[model samples]
Target: MNKTILSLTGAVLFATGAVVAQTMAQSTSESTVAPQEADAASVARGAKAWTNHCSRCHNLRSPSELNAELWDVSVQHMRVRANLPGAVADDIKAFLMSSATSTGVQYSTPGQGGASVASFAHLSPGDPLHGKEIYSQTCIACHGADGKGTISGVPDLTAAKGRLTKTDEVVLTNIIKGYQSEGSLMAMPPMGGNPDLTEQDIADVLAYLRKEYDIAPGTE
Candidate 1:
């Protein structure tokens, strides 16, 4: 009976060890992705939810409309009112915070001849790395991985003298509000169909495009 008891104890210990090892492996795998990437993924989800659900009721408020404190209170109140799941609400709030107008995100614009101007100098520079991640998630569908249009009539982002040559304000505004190229069959959706994308997201994406395609000011 002592041997039987020892055998059972060993079996239980082995099973427990296996479970712990598996759990640790899973956690390590999850930890490999940076928090920013995880957050960007969450923002993508929130963008979908915000567009599908929140817009159904009324016009969606701009992220710049409220401060972070106000957004927290508003999101909490709306979660209860709309019966939004806790996770969804949290994502929406995250979206709002990341894109908040007051966040002061900015990027520098380089002219063709190597002159650097502080474009949107009021805000901090957009993250090109983060922008690439967003582009992969959102823009890559229409704009190919190469920044060239994948579908028919889509603009080639690499054009030596094309859209990127336009002023920053014009480009940014066109994206925020959605624009249909004069000859295109369809208009590009606002925020590239990800409503949760912040102005920062757009800026990041623009920066990514400019850098990835080498389309700075006069160079375009």
Candidate 2:
């Protein structure tokens, strides 16, 4: 009777140990797979969000130009600019950082013999006149009619000397990526919240600003 009792206890212990090991293996697999799945989903959602909301305000550029810290600031500001819901905005930020500058390496833009000339010449021209109308409807409140900002601390569009001198690529990239100016409470919002605008619309607006404001494009 004593021997039978001991054998029963040993079998139970062995079974329990096997079950625990299986459980641990399963848990480890899930832990590894979950992050990869989440990352993929985040990228897909971010790409959609970029097309619908961001492409209107800016063009796609290499992610390497901005550091993760810069991207963090820019993404937060864009949340307000695009009027994105909290969850969606978070996803977009995650997506951009993962693909663009997560490695902290600087990226180069196309053309200009590797000089990193930023330009929207890749996109078609939009109607500058229509862009002006769009600007009036959405952007004028902050950027003003002349593209000069009326609010204190807003960038002066009429005198965007440094910005315009940046390659058309840089200007377009800024419009798309968005950024926080030093010592300013407000960041430039994406597309100024005009979801109807397309890539061409942004291109057109830049053209209008360059011509009307005499903002010269940068040379490589």
Which runs of model 2 end up more than 4 angstroms from their true locations?
A: 1-121, 160-162
| Candidate 1 residue-wise lDDT, 1-220, digit = tens | 9999999999999999999999899876787564423276666666556655676687666555677568777988999999999788877776665555432221222233332333464545667899899888767755778878655556788898777887765567556655556555544555765566877788888888888888775423
Which pairs clash (backbone N, Cα, C closer than 3 Å) in model 1?
105-123, 105-124, 106-123, 106-124, 106-125, 160-220, 161-220
* Native-structure RMSD, model 1: 13.7
**Residue-wise lDDT of candidate 2 within 1-220, one digit each (tens)?**
9999999999999999999989899886877575433254454455446445665576544344465467667878988987889667766665556545332121233343432434566787656687675565545655667666655556787665655676677666555544445465544444433334566777777877777788788773
Ten-residue region with minimum lDDT total, candidate 2: 101-110
- Residue 214 accuracy (lDDT) in model 2: 80
